[model samples]
Target: MEIRLAQRVQALTPSSTLAITAKAKELKSKGYDVIGLGAGEPDFNTPQHIIDAASASMNEGQTKYTPSAGLPALIKEIITKFKSDQGIDYSPNEVVVQNGAKHALYTLFQVILDEGDEVIIPTPYWVSYPEQVKLADGVPVFVEGSEENEFKITPKQLLDATTNRTKAVIINSPSNPTGMLYSEEELLELGKICLEKNILIVSDEIYEKLVYGEHKHVSIAQLSPELKEQTIIINGVSKSHSMTGWRIGYAAGNQSVIEAMTNLSSHSTSNPTTTAQFGAIAAYAGSQQPVDEMREAFEERLNIIYNQLIDIPGFTCVKPQGAFYLYPNVKEAAKLTGYKDVDSFVEALLEEAMVAVVPGSGFGTPENIRLSYATSLDLLEKAIKRMHDFVESKMKA
Candidate 1:
């Protein structure tokens, strides 16, 4: 028997981050004492109150299926969250909960994208964005952001990428891979371009709560009501509350888009887990003390790692304003080691230093790599030391 996969499925590649994570795990199992900086998740466990809320819900027999959109009370909480935190007013009916941020993203593409439709995604993006667009029969237009600009795309890039078949633009602030946060002024400029082009905005704010250093996250919807109508705001408690395993995420947008996502969700995952939804409700409603403490830990780690990484002989890193990852350019190290690219550089680092990092080539930026600080301070410090030693050794070689 022969095996052939669907074209869409064939187009999808396994997540590069996860593939590196698995390799790290395998090395760990072999007693390599690997330090995994490839993880994109928080190191902290879910808060006690959220766990208790899930238990309480379970005891209350809240195990039944919820409405395809989500439980009414949870949807109401999302509305309140958007209004209070993001300063955007969304009705409960205009929100749809899904398995996770990734689910929310894929579903949005399913509903909006058509064959050959183009989506403009700034480079150094999350690994899944381009693949998801391809799965939906859309072309992902890559707009480059360099180290000079802190890896952020300018409004001019958006204007240049716009075409008749360009259906949407993905804006991820406090971005994945780079940890670059967009300022309100920057977003306002880009939002104007999107509005002028009549293109939709898919704003992924999954890392909204994980920012630092006086960096404020501004929702495109908060920029203007018109932009809000054209925006699909994706967020969740996974990163905010360290509840990634619970898998609850949502999007707020036009009623038509919400309805479409809800309908697709009904036949798909049906709804996110009931207990997880209950837990997310508590995460949104509970005391934020835990959130503050976790953010502080991440901030401290970010500072320590940033300082150490940039001091390495052939490494240069941009100071991240948000999120827990640091993207460092190691082209000089690549040159010294004769590695030829970031992938070879990363593989050599893992083999010699037992430090796991994701190469930037996966995110469409070469000669750079991402290191997650979502680990212990001791581990982060040791990993930096090891990486520095490896780079210095390459220079000598």
Candidate 2:
């Protein structure tokens, strides 16, 4: 028998983070003491109220198919959330719910892009952004956001990347891997360029609520009516509400684009899970104390562990303003520990030190590694100590 796969599927790169996680899990299953610092979700459970809402919905027989885009109630909650959180107004026609924020992004690219169209992506980006763009037959144009600037692209950089085929640009504040947030001023400058160039903005704000002390999350869309009109916001409860498994994410943007995405989703997901939609509605409409508590815990962990991590031999890092990941430039650590690169160092750390961290190469930056603090304080401490000891033994300095 002969089998063939489509070129798009063939062109996809498997996630390095997931691969490392698989290996870590394999070791764990064999009773190895692996301390995984590659987590991407909150360590806490979903809020009790949200769980109760989903359970209540199931008990009350609310588990039938919903509107292809989402339940109307869920859409309404999303609308209210935007108004309250970002001070942006959205009509129901401009919002569409998808399986998750990842899916929301995937669907957005599908509807908005055509073959050979270009989307500008800042480097050190989330692993899935470029992949999703490519899946839509859209060309992803990468622009490096130097670590000196905390890995944020400049307005001039965005201007330089624009071309006749440029269709959109992605702005992921409180970014994954780097955990950097764009200032309001910075976003305004970039938004001006996009407005002049007529490039649509895809704003990924999944980590909006996880910002740390003295730093706040700002949406490029929140800058003005013009910017809001030019931007589509992709957000979900996964990171914000510890609802990773619920898979309820929504997009708010141009009515026409939203309509197309809704039509596309109808033929695909049909609808997000009914119970999960109910849970998301409750997540938005209920008290947000749990979200705040989770943010505080992450901040405490970041403050404690960032200091400890940088203390390790040959490691230097930018203190993240938000999110739970610590991205440290470990090229020196790699060299000092007798490894040739960050990827090999990460592998050796996992196998020898039993501390699992993600190599930054997957995020388009090979000199660094991402260590997620989305675990308990005790485990984070243990992982750092292991890395410290491993480096001390290998580096001898």
Give the top-scoring candidate (lDDT): 2
Which window of ten consecutive residues has the lowest lDDT sum in model 2? Answer: 388-397
Local accuracy of candidate 1 as per-residue lDDT tens digits, 240-295: 99988889999899999999999999998888899999999999889988998999
lDDT of 2 at 21: 91
TM, every model: 0.98, 0.99
* Runs with alpha carbons beyond 4 Å of true place in candidate 2: none
lDDT tens readout by residue for model 2, 1-397: 8789999999999997898899999999999999998989999999999999999999999979999889999899998989998899999999999999999999999999999999999999899999999999999999999989999999999999999999999999999988899999999999999999999999999999989888899998889999999999999999999999989898998999999999999999899999999999999999999999999999998988888999998999999998889999999999998998999999999999999999999999999999999999999999999999999899874
Stretches of candidate 1 above 4 Å error? none
Steric collisions counted per model: 0, 0
RMSD of 1: 1.0
